[model samples]
Target: MTDDVTTLAWAYLSRVAEPPCDEIATLVGEVGPLEASHRVAAAEVSDALRERTAARRDIHAAEADLNLLERRGGRLITPDSDEWPTFAFTGFGGAAVRERPQGRPPLVLWAIGPARLDEVAERSAAIVGTRACSSYGEHVAAELANGLAEREVAVVSGGAYGIDGVAHRAALAADGPTVAVLAGGIDVLYPAGHSSLLHRISNAGLLLTEYPPGVRPARHRFLTRNRLVAALGAATVVVEAGVRSGAANTAAWARALGRVVCAVPGPVTSASSMGCHVLLRGGAELVTRADEVVELVGRAGEFADEEPRPTGPLDGLSDAEKQVYEALPARGVRSADEIAVASGLAPTAVLGPLAMLEIAGLARRDDGCWRLVRTSP
Candidate 1:
């Protein structure tokens, strides 16, 4: 449990400094959240920190924000809270990640849900893609999300349309937990169309954000939000994306944070999959199925996809056997000489393979002719 003063201080910091406030973050880490709030309020911080807090430092909304949050049935999750995902966010403190505008971990999170944030994130994966997704993309996203849910991996994603919607719906359908990291305030669902979906998530899973209540979403906030989504999951999977999409941005953050990045390949002609192809070409792991994702993100040796093998009847046959099989018609019979001509094999060569095919049940002999056997429906 987090103390009231600490929560208030973090709430104030979250509102005043905006997000990814590296200077303020450093101040908080050094003096603690409560004291850092006091220092910033009294103008006792460094020049950089002062500049960051100069505008909104006078706005004391911590108490009011807390009141509104409580009214909305939400709570503030601070670093001191046991539910805070300390391990998941460890990468945000890295020197390389800190320099970027969207790299820093949130000062505090406003969340509404029943599940513990830390527990849900322990074995989670982020599934992201374009809003303008194709049907093929939708099918793949649903399958991946459903499989992940069945395996007890929480699905983390932005609660938007298209791929995000499909992922959440699939997870819910599977009766699994999910987290929606939003750009706007936790109470303010940005896309009005997803209100029902977002509400269900708040009841069953989690709705998290760095912004205080009543804050509307902006374009820049979405980019800032991507970092949290990337940090929460052990791996980030992109089902589909345009060349320059928010999904791609999230994938970049995942890579920067040293998280596994996986991309699903789509048709070369699909404009929606251009970004995933670009990622694949640039060294992202190619993930076609959910098992492959589990192998990459799950515990070591806990999961491994079986190597795909050829399933065709002629898979292990010699060239002559395959030619003979191919030459045999399904609807009618062919004499050995005709099969030989059709297979481009000598008459003598066709007889031996025909006998082998018959013994293997791949071919059926009728009087003096042969035809392919339909082994499966």
Candidate 2:
């Protein structure tokens, strides 16, 4: 919880300047939110800061906004709040982020849910992709989300259609915590069809945004909100994306913040997968399953994927044994003389390998004829 004065100041400042306003954020960092709000109101800040807030400075809605948030059962999370994720936003202080206002951290977040921001972000992974997704993309997103949830790793995603929607629903279906970083206010559910989904998210997970109540989702706001989605997650996974999609923007933010970027490969002919293939070519980790993603974001050695190995019964056979096995007909039996001819081995030598294969259950003898045996993996 935030104190009355401080919360009001944060709310005021949040509205005064659009988010990612480096100038205002810098001013607040220097003089604190309470004084910063007063300075902006009094026009005592630098020209750059003053100009940014000029249009909305006098339109003070702190109290009203707070009341609306409370009425809706939401919280105003300021830097002063216990719920603020300081560790997750540490990268916002990096030189790269400071150079770009779009990548900077938020001054205040409007959130609604039962989960704590910091706790949910401790081991979270952001799953994002384009709004127009194929069934393949949807399946992959759901699988990754469900798998991460089962491992107790929170799933973070924009609460939009396609990949983001699938990820959120899958995480909730698995009875795991998830966080939906919205582009608009927590109260303003964009993509009207997802209104029910958004409310359900608020009940089970969290609906978070930097925008105040009544702020509708705008194009620029969605792009600006990408930074938070990237920052909150330890890793960002792009399940499917076009060459130029919002998911790609989120991945770029993750890279800029030094977070692990993972991509799931799709068919070579899929236009929807071009972005992921581009990422893979540029050295992003190629993640096909949740275990692979967990290995990158989870604690070292905790969720490591097992090394792959051949599961065939012939895997450990010697060259001679393998030749004998291969020489055997897949659907029918073959005699010793026929096997020897097919394997390029002596008729007498074929007997020993055939005996080995039969003993190993890789081959079976019926009426003294050898036929290949198919074993379940």
Candidate 3:
């Protein structure tokens, strides 16, 4: 019975334009309440010869494919299946799958993974961003994935270049579960270069798609794919992106779906940072470090000790010295130019404070500039 429903649902999805979900719901009096059989019979299918001809062709093709899959003993999962993700029982999932003039979700999600659907939901977090990411962007993504893995958080991302690749690699290196939601078929590896990464994810994590096996990615498909990423994650983080990049689209989707949206701040001069800046301006939480992400996930206790310590000697320092100390990062060497930029002070103005900080043992100079040194506990 489940298999029959799956087949019928898949057939109906393949034949119709994304059904106008609201209209269908109004007709049925509840979202996703219309059965596949009912949908097929009630389609206000046009009688025009060309329209009818196309519909018939699509229906025939879907039926033929279903028969072949059944004959081959392939499994199918419908919304009624126990394995259906719990989110699917909510209005969000209904909205995702309902027919819209734009499109519909796959009637049956074809999946192969070590973790069950619910487990995927439990641990997932979407890490999305531009394909052309800067080195800093890559570093941020890797570090975030590493932190998430340490906490047993599952990393979810599109299997694209730049930030996506880094996120997946970090998760794999950490031996944590990860999932790559594809714009194409489970069998088709888009971009070709990430074939190894894709294979590793399938073996170690999960690889999923709305499209059936053997379908290649198309331009429009990626936009549609973003919704799935948003749906799957409890939150979405944009590591780095351009003003108009696809990451913004994914972030928007996350917001629409009521998922937490996070943006990692970068050098303001970087073009890739523009999207993140915009997101921050629009109320996305600003994340500068990995613990910020953990905190955003409400696991603050997991990272409370990782918080940045007070910059420098708070004892007996003048106001100016305190200001300079406060501006320095807890660790890492910095050149004078970098320190000046960070402190928002001229190099000349900073020298006095630097001398004070060094004498007070609140900071130390290495190479050319200053670094905030932690006092003994």
Q: RMSD in Å for candidate 3, one decimal?
A: 10.7
- Candidate 1: list runs displaced more than 4 Å: 87-94, 300-377
Write the residue-wise lDDT of candidate 3 on 1-377 in tens digits. 86665466554553343322233324333434336335445554234323433444344445555554455333344556576674421233335534442233344555555656667677667888888999889988999999888887788899999999999999999998888888875667887999999888877887766666556788677887887777677778999989988889988877766667889999899999999999999988667665556545653112123333354348667655665877788788777656666665555556888888888777899877678889876
Model 2 TM-score, all chains together: 0.78
Q: Quote each prediction's TM-score.
A: 0.77, 0.78, 0.66
Tens-digit lDDT track for model 1 on 1-377?
Answer: 55787888889999888787888888888989989999999989999888988999999989999998887788899888889885434343367666765677788899998889999878899999999999999999999999999999899999989999999999999999999999998778969999999999998999999998888999999999998998888889999999999999999988777788899999999999999999999878788877777766765222123333456776788667887988998688999999987876667778999999999999999998998898763
Please provide, for model 2 over 91-134, each residue's C-alpha lDDT reduced to its tens digit, 9 standing for 90 to 100: 42467566777767788899999999989988889999989999
Output the better candidate (2/3) by TM-score.
2
Q: Kindly report which residue pairs in candidate 1 clash with one another.
A: none
Global Cα RMSD, each model: 12.2, 12.2, 10.7
Question: Candidate 3: where are CA atoms >4 Å away?
Answer: 1-75, 88-106, 299-377
In model 3, pairs of residues that clash are: 18-100, 19-99
The lDDT of each candidate is 0.87, 0.87, 0.69
